[model samples]
Target chain A: MNQYTAQQWRRYTIRVGIYVALLLMTAIFLIPVYVVIVTAFKNPAEINLASTWQLPTELYWQSFSEVMAEFGPRFGNSVQLVIGATILSSIMGSMNGYVLSKWEIPGHKFLFPLMLFGMFIPYQAILIPLFEFMRDIDLYGGIPGLILIHVVYGLPITTLIFRNFYVDIPDEMLEAAAIDGAGFWKLYTDIVFPLSIPGFVVVIIWQFTQIWNEFLFAVTMTSNDAQPITVGLAQLAGGEAVKWNLPMAGAIVAALPPLIVYIVLGRYFIRGLLAGSIKG
Target chain B: MKNNRDRSIAFLMLLPSLILLGIFVYFFIGRAIQSSMTDWGENPAQPPLSETVEISYVGLDNYVRLMTSFTESSFRVSLVNTFFFTIFFVAGCIMVGLFLAILLDQRVAGEGIFRTIFLFPMALSFVVTGTIWRWMLQPRGGVNILPTLIGLDPIDFAWVNSQETWFQFLWQDVPRILTFVGIGILLIMAVRYALNQRWRSMGFVAAAAIVGLLVFMAGAWDYIWPALDVPAAEPTIAPKGFNVALLGVIIAAVWQMSGYTMAMFIAGIRGVAEELREAARVDGASELGVYRYIILPQLNPIILSAMIILGHISLKIFDLVFAMAGPDNAKTIVPGILVYTKGFRANAFASASAVAVIMLFFVAIIIIPYLWTQLRSDDD
Candidate 1:
């Protein structure tokens, strides 16, 4: 009884320690969010070096109103860009994955990695050529161009996610369809596409967050009329006089949809991450 | 005979992705290489060219200029900055990640809350994180004042603007550093040799060490001479220690990414069978011992994958740096920003491409072998 009590005491101590450490790390992680929230809620006059961490004594909506006025239209561009990129890439990826994993062809194994390597290539390495290519193709300076780039670049990871997902599917399933004389399109539409709803969710959420948050390509590829929210937010922050309240408000506004998705559909996002990039 | 039809169809299915990647990825890589080898936008003699700009063969001149020119100290500084950032950024992520993963593995209360809070930063764009962190790290703002509330002087560390460095050296001492690093690597190999008792490989390592030492002592080797007269001047900028400004950027990046690594690790730790831990405990292994020995060895693959992912991200870090410190902020320069500044801003296309290629090679060094093994293992 004495030994058991000591063990319980040790376990309790360890548990408390773990909770304390976790709470501390979580507080550290949430500092930026907390700062953004408080600053966003404060009046412009209240936002200064001295009161950066202070709570708002009174509510202020002017910052949000101003930020929304600047970012409202640009947010549409982000939505359209993400939606278009997500749908197109998810479909392309599903097909590519089906063929790569299920429909083995000559050199398919070799070809898969060659294509998969694109996911790991830094966008900086491809920026200039991609810009020039977009210009030559007459897709530059528009959301369409950004959409195409995101989809094309997005294929590798989406394809990887779906391929890994499909790899688990018993071969007998594909064989059964084949034996039934379902042609390629029929096989995919009938079986593969139907079963790929989970994969679509994962890929769509992944692409949505990535394309929405993407700043480099958006800044370089699109110009004044077509700038995404990320570029707009940066420009807002970069104005001659630093308007902390406005940018803080815009940062929260910009982060809202993805934040909501991360909170709501976080499981799928985590699933995609594990199945996609960091897989070894 | 019937298999040929399905095979062709499979090939057809792969055609779209193949063609797209081929054009955008492979074809553009070739284009970048070609551009790097040519003087496209550097000709001051020509009127500013437009879409159909003509490029002349420069024969490695751009690379030479970047490597040797004193006018481009910023580029060299960016390289050193990236090196230091990659080391600290990756180390911080791994350590913090492993720590969080272990804590979460204890099955503590509010696991979902902790996981959600830890991961939500990753959902925010780098721009957002940068904006927040930039404010927080301000001289009199967020983080600096926390100490004052606790009865301490506001720690007035010059975070992003500190010109001072820790381990100052000279650029000309690169070969010395390389030789020292090589010797250190050789010592590690020797220790491994002692443990594995592999005499033949140890003999080979010794021979290679001797050859390496001989080359190091030679100081200059002209195995393939260019026969050009040596320039009277060399790069004059003295090397400095890792920039302290990058500490801010590293902190933000680790904050955004350590959660990702933690998630990966938590998954890994959960996948580790409970029986293994119980068996180790029964054998008198302490909890720390169980994690240090039994669990960690099994988690090697997770650790490796996390390292590679974090390493590549650090090597190509641009968005956070650009958003936090503006483009010309020399204290936190990195290769990705250099590529942008050179190519887009300065119209130094050739040198920009060269830098891009160099960055690509660094990532390739980390990724290729791991990928080759993954693909090969899948084949079985």
Candidate 2:
């Protein structure tokens, strides 16, 4: 009885230790979020070095109003860009994945790896040529062009995630549809497409977050009129005589859409994240 | 007849993507390679953006200059900075991730909440992360002032603007250092192969190691790649090393990405069969021993995958550094920023493409092997 009590006590101590460690880590991870929130809420007059960590005296609505005014157009641009790009890329990825995984496409063994390689190359390697090509085609500076860039570049990973997702779907299901005189299009629509809602969710979340948060293409591919929220936030934070509150507000505003998606559908988000890297 | 038609339909469906990817990924890469070997922006006669400009082929002149030119010290520094950043960022993510995974694996309360807090940052843009961290790491405010709340002097460390460097090395010695590092890796590989009793592979690795050692001893690096030699006029010995300013950027990067690794590890830890762990515990293993001996070994592949993913991300890191330390801050410059500033700002297209090509080479070095192994495993 004494030995058992000692073991229980030790286990209790270990559990307590784990919680403490976890809480400490949690605090560290959330520090920036805390700072960003507090800074965003603090009035410009109250924002300074000495009172950095202090809670705001009162809620300040001015920063958000000002940031919204400045970033309103860019925010719309990001939405349009993300939505257009996400839908196009996800549809294409699903079809490609369906064909590659379910159909008997020749050279798929070689093609899959070739496509996978595209996602990993530093986009910098192709940036110059892409810039020139965009210019030559008169698609250099608009939301549509940016959408195209995102969709094309996004194909590899979206296709990858969907392919991995589709491989799990039994081939017998497809064979049955084929035997029912369902041609390729009918089979996909009847059997595969309906079953891919979960895959679509994963791909959509991944692409939305990626295209929304993307800075390089947004900054480079778009002109001033088509700049995304990322560019606006960058300029807001990057100015010489910036009020911290405004940029902090901008950061929060820019981060919210994806944050909401992540918080709500986090399981699918993680599935997308893991699928992009780890093989199924 | 139906199968042939179906195959044709499949081919037709794949055609557009194949064409797009071919142009955007492969064909454009070829174009960038060609652009990098030109004098488009270097020569006075060929303005980079001119409608009717001449672009003469320079045959690796841009690469040679980037590697050795006195004016291009920034490129070399950026290269070294990326190397250090990748090492620390990858290692930090794995350690933090593994720890968090272990802690959460203990059936902790509110695991979902803790996980959400940890991972929410991953959803934010690097630009957002950079902006927030830039504020938090302000020299006079933010994190620096946190100590004051606890009754200490406000810490005054310059997070993003520090000019201090660590582990300094002369530019002239880079070749020797690379050679030595290569030899070290080969030696390690040889040992691992020996342990596995793979004599033929071990013999090949040993041969490579011996050749690397001979090259190092003979000091043939400069003679073989003469561009690495410092130019005579700038003989003051350009020094390159890890800049302290990048510490803040690396910290922010790790903060954002460690969650990803944690997720990977948690999945890996959960995948470990309960029976294996129970058996280990029954054999008198401590909880720590079960993790250190059993769980961690099974997580090796997750760790490798995480490392490769994070490594490539770090290698091409641009936006975070750009947002935290603006494009012109030489102290925190990276190749991605250099490409941006050079091509976009300075119109130095040739040099920009050269830097970009170098970045691609480094990424390819890490990614190709990973993809090969990963895809091959899928085939099996």
Candidate 3:
């Protein structure tokens, strides 16, 4: 009885220790973020000499206005790009998934595998060729090009998701809808899309984050005219007179939009992550 | 009829994406391969403005150059670093992620806060995140501050790029007693596996223990010794040895990736059927046995799929390394970053494109089997 009691206490202590250690690591993860937040509010003079780990003598907001005047619309462009791509790609992906699940389309078996190969090629491989394609068509410098590449870039995962989820749904329900002679528009807008909102939300948030945070394609495809906030802000900081305060301010501004969207639609991000992770 | 319409609708919907796949994924991959063969690199300038720029069809010239060229120090390190970098990345992300996943999975207090905190790294762009992390990891920066406060000797980042790590990689690592013991166990287990026969349950357990030991040793040995010899440090910005900065850089990668891992695992856990738990209880199985047998079986598909995807993700990982090591030394990879440096920055766009093509091919060799299995398994 005494030995049993001892074992119980030991187990309790170990569990507590593990939890504390985890809490500590989690704190470590947040330190850099904390630094960004504190530094964003500090002055140029303050940030230059002040320890990144230390708080400034006073809360400074001078850089915020400077950042806003410089890159505010670019931030909006980024948002528009993310929302547009997420909606377009998820719509396309879900629709494809629904069709493949519901009907026996000719050549989908081959076409789908061919498309699956897209996920295999790294972003670097197609940079030049894609540039040539975009440049040839004159879509290389605008939001239209960014949207095209992003939608294309993200389609495989989104299609894979909608397909997997559609497979799990009963085919008889779709057949019943079809027996009523429902056309594609009615079926998609009413039946298929409504049923797939949870999945759609997940894909939307995930895609939004990707397009928002994307740097390379934004850097490559579009030069200055429609360069997403990622490339714009990064280049802004690349100047010789680059101050830590200004970039930290830009970074904080850049992070806030997605971070807000993330928090608002936060629940779906987890769901999307799981669905996206549909392996093992 | 509904199925017919749905099928057509699906076909139309999938069309744009199919075109994307054709142009971006499939066609680009083809171009990458073709570009590797063509003499795209700087050619001797000729009179009369040659229209073709002398696209010589040199089969395997790019590969040979990649293999034989010892001219660029960082280029060589990046190529060799590819496999080891991938191993460290996969190992780190999974280990750190699994630890957090388990921690967050517990019925502990403030779990949501912890989860959110851990996940915040995913929010920042690699450019900003990379630059910031670079500063933080600077041996002179205060990234080591928190550690210093704890009184457990803070790390000096200077030695991270120092020469001590370089010279050790080309030689065999000295074996310690623990490693020798591990070797003996492996020898015994290899003999056991070769002579597969009906053995006592204890023998099965013993063999399992040896296999586990081998895996553990694989990780330990990789960490304990440098993969390359550390040459003495030079005054220039050149990389010396398997720079210690690589490890610090990957630690940053781990921080960024672990949140996704945790989020994915949580989803997988949630998807596990509750009925299985009741069934296990009815079968009089212990809770541990229920988790081991039932929960794990269901998790197998999700885990395997995650591994394949994450494995490939780590293989192509560029942002984190770029963020941690800067573009020059710390994050060089064989295919991706090497191409970037050579092609665009170095003005040898031809060689860079060639490098890009080679990377695509290497990625294919890894991805083909994964695609085959996923499609086949789905078909089954």
Candidate 4:
């Protein structure tokens, strides 16, 4: 009886230990969020070295207004960019994935790997030529041009996720459809497309977050007028900033769209992330 | 005829993406390689951005200069920074991720809320992460002042702007250091092969290690790669290694990405059959033993996948450093920033492309093998 009681006590200790460690890690992870929130709410006068850990005396919401006023146009640009890029890439990826996984087009064995390789290369490797090519085609320095770049670069991962997603739909389902007089387009539109809502959700969220957060291309490819929120936030936060409250506010503003998507559709977002790396 | 027509339609549907990817990925890479071998900006007569610039080819000179020249020491420093950053960032993410996954696997309550808090950072932009961390890691303020709540003095470590370096080594001795590293890897491989009783593979690895050791001992690297020789214009030695300022950026990166690995590892852990674990437990294995021996072994592939993903991301890191340290901060400059500053700021197109190609080479070294194996395994 004493031995059993001792074992129970040991197990209880371990369980408590696990919770303590988890809570400590949780606190560590949330530190930046805490800092960002408190600092964003504080008046500029209250934001200093010594008082950083202290709560604000009262809520100061002026920084958000100022940041919103300055960042209004860039926020619109990011929305337009993400919407256009996400829709185009998701549809194209669905089509390409359906064709590659279902139809088995010739040279797909070669072509699939070739396309997948595009996603892994550093964009820096192709940035110079892309800039020149964009200029040559008269598409540089605008939201539309940025949209095209995102869509093209986005094809590899979007297609990869969708392809891996589609692989589980059972080839027999497509084969049965084909026997029932479903042509390529007919099969995709009637069967595959109807069943692809989950895939679409995953791809859209992933691409939306990626295109929205991207900075290097946005900074390089866009002119001042077409800058996204990320580049705008960088500019606002960059330099010897006299003010800290504004950038913190701007970061919260910029991070909201993707954060919302992730919170709402977190399961699918994780699916997209895992699909990009681990094979089905 | 219907089948053939359906095949044609399928091919046609994919044709547009194929063309776009061809131009955007393959053809542009070729163009970058071609431009890297040119004197577009190097020559005074051939300006980089001019519409009708006269271009002349200067094969590999830009690469040679980047590798050896004293004036281009920043490029070397950036490369070293990338090396150390990739190592720590990848290691930090994997360790933190495995820890979180192991904790969450314990059937804890409120797992969803804890997970959401841990992973919310992944949704935010690196620019946002960089901005927030910059404030949080302020020399006197955010994290430094936390200890004061417990009656301790405020910490004063310079987070983003530290100029201190660690593990410093001379640039001139890089070849020798690399050779020794290569031999070390080979020797380790030989030991593994020998343990498996694969004598042929062991012999090959052992021979390679011996050859590497001999080459290092004989000091023949300068002859093999003339770029290792010190240039005549600047005879002074330059030191390069890990910079202290990058720790803040690395910490921020790990914070944002560790959740990603956690998600991957959770999936991997759940995929491990409950019966296997139960059997191990029934055999009188402790919980730690089950994890150390049974579970961790099954997670090897997931760990590799995470490392590859994190490794490539670290190799091309730009925005976080750019936001935290600014582009002009020499202590935290990476090759990605160098490409931007050189091409966009200095109009040194050839040199920028050269640095970019080198970055591509490093990424390709890690990515190609992983992709090959992944695709090959999928074929089964």
Model 3 per-residue lDDT tens digits across residues B1-380: 53555556657776766777787877876776776676665555521124456666778665555533444445555655665666777777766765677666657788877877777677666766765665565564557554665666666555224343443342222334445666677567656765776356446657766666766667766654333333332213344245554666666777777787767666666677778778888999965577678766776665565566666776566655554454555434445666666665654555666777756667777677777776767776
Off by over 4 Å in 1: A1-4, A278-280, B1-6, B220-238
Q: Give the per-residue lDDT digits (tens) of candidate 4, residues B110-222.
A: 99988888888889899999999998888988888888999999887898888788888776667878888888899999999999999999999999899878877887887
Decreasing lDDT order of the candidates: 4, 2, 1, 3
- Candidate 4 residues lying further than 4 Å off, grouped into runs, are A278-280, B191-198, B217-220, B223-238
Give the TM-score comparing model 1 with the true structure, all chains together. 0.96
Q: Which has the higher TM-score value, candidate number 1 or candidate number 4?
A: 4
Write the candidate numbers in order of decreasing TM-score: 4, 2, 1, 3
Q: In terms of lDDT, which candidate is strongest? A: 4
Task: Provide a comma-separated list of chain B TM-scores, one per candidate.
Answer: 0.93, 0.93, 0.71, 0.94
Could you give candidate 4's per-residue lDDT for residues A226-264 as a string of tens digits?
A: 999999999999988548899999999999999999999
Model 3 interface DockQ: 0.50
Ranking by DockQ: 4, 2, 1, 3
> Whose DockQ is higher: candidate 2's or candidate 4's?
4
Per-residue C-alpha lDDT of model 1 across residues A221-262, encoded as one tens digit per residue: 898889999998888887447979888898999899898999
Residue B162 error, candidate 1, Å: 2.2
TM-score of model 4 (CA atoms): 0.97
Clashing residue pairs found in predicted model 2: none
Query: Which parts of model 3 have CA positions greater than 4 angstroms off?
Result: A1-8, A48-50, A236-242, A278-280, B2-13, B46-54, B147-154, B159-167, B170-192, B198-241, B268-304, B330-334
Residue pairs clashing, model 4? none
